[model samples]
Target: MAASKIAIYGAIGANVAIAVTKFVVAGITGSSAMLSEGIHSAVDTFNGVLLLVGIRLSQRPATAEHPFGHGKELYFWSLIVAVLIFGLGGGVSFYEGIQHIRHPEPMRDATWNYVVLGLAALFEGTSFFIALREFRREARGRPFWQALDQSKDPTTYTVLAEDSAALAGLGVAALGIWASHRFDMPALDGAASVVIGLLLAGVAVLLISQARGLLIGEGIRPETARAIRSLAMQQPSVQDVGRVLSMYIGANEVLAIVDVNFKDGTATGEAADAIAAIEQQVRARFPMIRRLFIEASEAPVDAAATA
Candidate 1:
């Protein structure tokens, strides 16, 4: 139902079909690149399943032992998926490529390779477009790289990256197959596999970095923090707002803690009322902030200025 689910399901379905076809063709034609592509697809299939599991686990309600809920489960699983992509998908592909290079086999008729690759391109392209569409909708006109950098949802982007790499790898495999047969040199097939491996490794590294940041605790945007501080300062009973600390506890949920210094002569009841008003305003503007705590304090103006 969700956009992320749609992209991930589409990818899994396409990869399952393509992987099976690729392995069959690889066995028939002995193309190293085909086998590598099959391995890549298989890894993607498993990764999709893991992401779904993460989504389910992340929805669990908060418990006494884990007051923040299981929101971080998704980040943990996403990190695991990145590691698997690097180890099984990238490492195995590289090793297979090196072996193929070391022991070159006689080239066979590549007509079937062409057929399978063309079909794979079609399937991968369809999945890629689906993911790209969802990402664009989420970006809302933000530049691609900038939106991707600021994105908190991992499912949509992870699927997009995997599909992008699949499309690129298919192109490389096709080119390598064509060149090896045309030039009577089979080593090019192995070279293509190596390139695919490197591509997967690079994507895996980027995903790992993002997952690590989320799992540890990534905060809301600086602009959003500043806006919240301004809201607090607008309250008549408030002197200043200080140390507006915030972190994303889930893809669409944030936990924020704000330190506020009330007016010098404000009554306790009035300060409490102001705190309630500030919380209401912040939450109204930013529904993603599921949990907000405002602490009354006597903080320095300089400190209050820095959200």
Candidate 2:
């Protein structure tokens, strides 16, 4: 629903159009490089559609069955997208490129191929810039790779990955088309395709790593842990926290479980009610945390707590 999401849809829309055009041109030209590039773009279009669907479904409101919300599902779908990109786009392209390199073929009307590649590059460049703009906006005051690492916003991650891949693919297409045109050596085109395949594989690895972290319920940074510690001490019944554990359950949801030392010899019934109250307070203060459980701990005083 955000502006960046709309921009991603535009990128997706353009890719579908470009993929169709590229496929027709590649078939007409009988160029293996062009065919590989077409397949690459076609896969990209599919990836974009998958991202859009993931983004949409991930936004669904929480249900009774999934009281924590349906956020982790996004990570699962994103991981699947990554696998598809690597296997379908990268593997297929690598195989086709090797075949072309071994057995050269005559190409017809290289001009149209070059023209389409250039035009598609221009469009894809625009889309990449839009994604970059959003990335920069959200990643303000942080290193680029760090921002990419810490960004929990699904839309940013999905669109950023797709557009980055799309723009790079465009570059590869252009280089291959130009090389094949210049020397009339189809092998250069094939080599370019090999490079494109590697790029896709690299991007796939990135997506999968990030998605895997999310699926495993990785927690926020130590700073967030510190914030929670400070808030826990504010509860009058809680003397000090003993053991704390927290993991991110969604973009804005953390699953928090705490072991705290309440005042010694406090009334058992009162202590039970007090622990429940502390849990509610923690959840209220940190709306991002969906679940909180407080258990009593008998331990020595330690000012510092880790989550």
What is each predicted model's overall lDDT from 0 to 1?
0.89, 0.76
RMSD of each: 4.6, 5.5
Clashing pairs in 2: none
Off by over 4 Å in 1: 140-143, 299-307
Tens digit of lDDT per residue, candidate 2, span 1-307?
A: 3755766677787778788888899889876667777787788778777767776777788899987777776677778888988998888888888888898776677889878888888877877778778778767679988887778766677777776776777678678868877898888778877887888889888888888888887886787677777777776767787656887766666788878787765556556666767777677766777778777785333333321
Cα-based lDDT at residue 276, candidate 1: 89
Tell me the TM-score of each prediction against the true structure: 0.93, 0.82
Per-residue error (Å), model 2, residue 101: 0.9
Model 1, span 60-163: residue lDDT tens: 99999989998888888889999999998899999998888999886677999999999999999999999888888878899999988888888888898899
Model 1 TM-score is 0.93
